[model samples]
Target: MKKKSNKQVLEMLRNMAEGLGQTFAPFCEVVVHDLSNPKNAIYAIENSLSGREVGQSVTELGLARIQDPEFPAVIANYANTFPDGRKVKSTSIGVKDDSGEYVAALCLNVDLTLFQSFQAAISQFTKIDEKEVHEHIEAGGNHSDRIHARIDDFAAARATTSRSLKPADRKQLVQELKKAGLLEVRRGAEIAAAHMGVSRATVYSDAK
Candidate 1:
């Protein structure tokens, strides 16, 4: 099979991203990573939810995909978190040339925070006096509470308690948070570092 040129592959991926982003509306962010160019790997982005523009540097996972031949070809429905403490669900699909080398990747990130708030509103509006109600939105807009909840959610995805998370686990958690734009929030790194029981420098390094 003839290998597709990087330009062709990226163009296809860009179209797919734009179409998917439109179909999903505002909650989903679709990004195309050109692994051949790590410093400016975000070849295109649609429905930008993470404040990252095209030409932004590739993520740690992006670098991994470029450098590691054995990197997984697909990752689906992984836990992710935003800087302002919003949770996300994400999927990544590696795009390989006919030569069987990875040339690009398409990632979809779905912000679940808005959906949670919407669920809360509907629950309140349709509630009965005796029915049990579970509130997804925390009261008072407490940043600390939200941060803690995010940590716990990350830990839960790994089937472990936050206190029991290992160093490697914590690093992976940091990476996910970084990709979701959480580390960019004011004091976000500090809060995540404290919750993970690591130094602030360590948290930053984990993202690297």
Candidate 2:
């Protein structure tokens, strides 16, 4: 077994940064900093969300790691913000040479703007009146709505749309509907079939 040189280690880290950037693309920025050259430390950058470029100076964290051999090798999930004011979650990992001197740093910055917007949307979408109202509703309409809701729920549980369910999943959904006695309701088969984008005969076959 041979120890890898600092350059070799940094190259490997650069490759890893590229792969990680691609894997979490559109939201994550990966950077590799060569600490030995603090003036132009950024050796590589992928998914450049922060508008920073290669050859940029080392970050404060990277400088800290270079200044202190005893610094933590990994500083993870720290709150950060991009130059454009996007909130970020960041992780920085220090790479040291065999002599235990910091040689490079690999960092990841994940943008949270899209996720924050999605969270806000979900909060508003799920907000409802706390007070309950007792009102007369049509039984036929209620039954039909319930049937369609069940189908939608089933598909959601499987991480798919009702019409995009695989054959086996569709069969299982039909069987569950039959067991729940939903299939016995008037026009239930027709409703389920229509919602699932299948024929009534196909729904009946799946029920069996």
Candidate 3:
């Protein structure tokens, strides 16, 4: 097997960076830095969220890795900020040559501004009034409603409508309802039959 040259390795990393950029597009910036040429280190860039160009100088982190062989090869999920003050989550990877010399760096900077906004929106949307406003919406305690709910839930679990449930599924639903004591409720079989579009006799047969 042949070892890849630094240029070849960098090219492959460039391609990988492009793919990553596309996968996380509109939210991430992917960059490739050629550590061998610190003066013009930016070899390729995708999804330019940071507005950086391909011919830009190496970042401080890149330069540090280039100078220090013992520097960590991967630094992940560090907090960063864009020039425009947008919050960012970043990861940097140092690529080393066969001689164990750092030759390039692959970096990903994910913009968190939109996600932060989404978080804020969700927080506000789910906020409830502190004032006491008693409301009884769920009929979970009602025997009739519970029976109907169980049948509907069983049908949904099988990805079918209650009326479209197969014989085996209907029998399973009846067993589950019996276990829950819902089948013992007065007129429970009638209610289940109505909801499931089946005859009460059929419900009783399945329950047995």
Candidate 4:
């Protein structure tokens, strides 16, 4: 098979860079570096988030790869920072020809500023503030009112009319009322039985 020329390789990488840039736009930059020309390695750039342009010199990493034949084929998700202090994550891939010499590279730089902001929001949302107030209900007269309120609360939580509750639901209600100490109140069983349209015996059976 005939080996591809430098121009052909550059054309292929240019198409790849353009596609990657369009897919991840605004937050990602795609650069195609012609490693054979270290003095002006950036042959193409798209979605240029870092303000770099064509004809730019190879980066320090690129130079390292040029000096070392054993350089990794793919270096991924390494941390980077832009000039303005925005965090970025990057990946670089070395492209070789039929001769197995690194001739070009494709690099992707992803801005992490938005992701960091989301992290900060999640952290703040989950944090417990010690100064926040805890509510309490005043202990006073009107035990019957409290009992009635408890029954109403239970009915509302079940999303059904108290009087229309089935025998099984009435049993569950009785269990809840007993747990709340409402069943121990005077006339509690009679009031609950009437409210739930069930016999007092049924409430007592459920509480047992």
Model 2 vs. true fold: TM: 0.73
Instruction: Please give the lDDT score at residue 185 for candidate 4.
Output: 79
lDDT of 4 at 96: 81
Per-model C-alpha RMSD: 20.7, 4.1, 5.3, 11.2
Residue 6 local lDDT, model 4: 76
> Residue 136 of model 1: what lDDT?
43
TM-score of each: 0.57, 0.73, 0.74, 0.60
Please tell me which predicted candidate would have the highest TM-score against the true structure.
3
Model 2 per-residue lDDT tens digits across residues 1-208: 1234867988999999999999999899999999988999999999999999999899899889999999999999999999989999999999888789999999999999999999999999999888888653634566678888999999999899999999999999999999988899888898899899999999999999
Model 1: ten consecutive residues of lowest lDDT: 135-144
Which clashing pairs does model 2 show? none
Q: Report the number of clashing residue pairs per model.
A: 1, 0, 0, 0
The per-model lDDT (C-alpha) reads 0.85, 0.92, 0.88, 0.85
Candidate order by decreasing TM-score = 3, 2, 4, 1
Write candidate 3's Cα lDDT for 1-208 as tens digits.
1234878978999999989989999899999999998999999999999988989899899989988989999999999999999999999999998788899999999999999999999999999989877754643347777787788888888899989999998998888888888877777777788889999899889989
Q: List candidate 3 segments past 4 Å from native.
A: 1-4, 141-174, 183-208
Model 2 accuracy (lDDT, Cα): 0.92
